[model samples]
Target: MKIITLTFFSALAISVCSLIGPTSRAATGIGDECNKGGDVKFAIREYDNKLVSVCRADGVGDCLYTKAFGKTFVDNRLHLNSDRLHDYVIKDLSGSYGDNDVTHFMLFAQCRDGNFVKVGDDFFTNLRPDAMDRTTGWLKLRVTRDCYNDSISDTQERSYTIVFDPKKRRYGPPDSNPKLTHYCSDAELALPVGSANSSR
Candidate 1:
């Protein structure tokens, strides 16, 4: 019985050692760790100071996202009549949304010039770009619909004016012209970024 116990212990040690390999034994079987699973969502809201279009971009809030816990069930989401991507690029384009508890994100972009490319990893966070010009990079942006171990929140509604620098070939907020002090300010839930009656 003593010999048998010794052999059993040795076999257990060998089994653990075998799992340390690179590819084949990364982790498998009942004792292995599982990857966190969840979905990611992003919503974009844009508007002037009137607070008409400052609705929930995500089911909870505006055009925003995160790499962690997502929005709650108590969200006052935006009610949309269509899922169609309208005016893929708009000036004063800023919004917010929740992360839904996930890690790892990639943003894909499609320009009006038909140039499609991915924005790589984790480039957006508490991000409120001042403006968007179709001629520039903000024509279209995409987010990971699925995620792993992440969290996020939303952006408010305000006037976000974007302009394109033809020579610089870039987009940015102006120093003072139509200064977007409250680009996404005073945003409430369950409102749409269009007409007041349109917001739910």
Candidate 2:
């Protein structure tokens, strides 16, 4: 078993779900917490704050992945709907299907009272900067059916620029975004392609 750790300082901006009277919110830089795991492990930790995320391996193969006992954490901040506070994006290992393993990306937002809360459902899979962008405070997620494992199949991808509405207290166009693109490739998916048993 091995462990990896990352430490850095960054300021995040995000806001809450409920519409309450505004309070003084600080644009503070949060910290990360992480733990150890399998053949390979990854964690992001901060020296000051209490926030943390960890990913442990559950199964052994060409790639290390978490299943029932496995967990992965991320601490990327996004300015979803507001400028005072920042939203957070996290990644997790959901589960597996046959020879394939699945991961999920979740979004968390802070409220007017200075508390963080989950904004929506598990809305993304294999989420990354290559497939999504949050630089403008609006999210442009290039959606695709994930093929993270060795399994490859016919798939289509789309790109959507989702905006958060403060008046409505929600991200707009809850349904699938407009703009269908092309099929998915192995390199685009960022995982090894072909059968699992095939020699690397």
Candidate 3:
């Protein structure tokens, strides 16, 4: 009876220990590898390991190494960080649009529960790089689109000012007066069903 009881208690303890082990979900996201390998320093780890700027032992030279996502390149020139709105980071990412044009846009991210999550939707799809401007608390971007509505089959450009609202936790259109123009979104530009251009 004593031997059987001991075996039952040992099995219960092993089951509980397995439940206490770290979960796979916790090992995902940006900066997840910061804590691994060699000596390291964290420039920004206030949000846990979810969003961090860390230099590992593999860093070039002596502690001069600073990196974010491994292998994922981020343009330092266009990167922006804000503490007034919850230590969020905005990265300007550039990529090819269609086949010919290259487009630029911004991504807003924040740390939540040891994971980095996107904070907002992009306001400009095809941003004009040369026309982008940033002030103390505002971001202005010029967007271009090849608009084709009825007889209008030409490219148009518009300016927009984006502001962050603390309550909303995302960048959005401004409230005050500004020189800006709103255009039809891609959904609106789609040809109607069975229209003359629908097949094409």
**Highest lDDT against the true fold, candidate:** 2
TM-score winner between 1 and 2, please give it: 2
Q: Order the candidates by TM-score, highest first — what do you get?
A: 2, 3, 1
Question: Ranking under lDDT, best-scoring first?
Answer: 2, 3, 1
lDDT of 1 by residue, 7-32 (tens): 99999998877775443332121112
The TM-score obtained by model 2 is 0.39
lDDT of 2 by residue, 1-200 (tens): 12222221111122232223242121221111011111122322322232344332333243332233244454377654334465566655544433323345555554443344444334343433322223323344333243333334443232333444434333443222221112233433442333221112
In the order shown, the candidates' Cα RMSDs to the true structure are: 20.8, 17.8, 15.6
lDDT of each: 0.27, 0.36, 0.35
Q: Which of 2 and 3 is the better model by TM-score?
A: 2
List model 3 lDDT by residue over 1-200, tens digit each.
99999999999998877875443322222233323332133233322323334332234454221233322223222222222223233323333334222233333333333333332334343542232222323233333333334445443333333444434434444221221123334542452422322212
Cα-based lDDT at residue 140, candidate 3: 36
Q: Which stretches of candidate 2 lie over 4 Å from their true place?
A: 1-70, 97-102, 126-140, 147-158, 161-168, 172-200
**Of candidates 3 and 1, the better by TM-score:** 3
- Work out the TM-score per prediction: 0.18, 0.39, 0.32
Evaluate residue 20 in candidate 2 and report its C-alpha lDDT on the 0 to 100 scale.
31
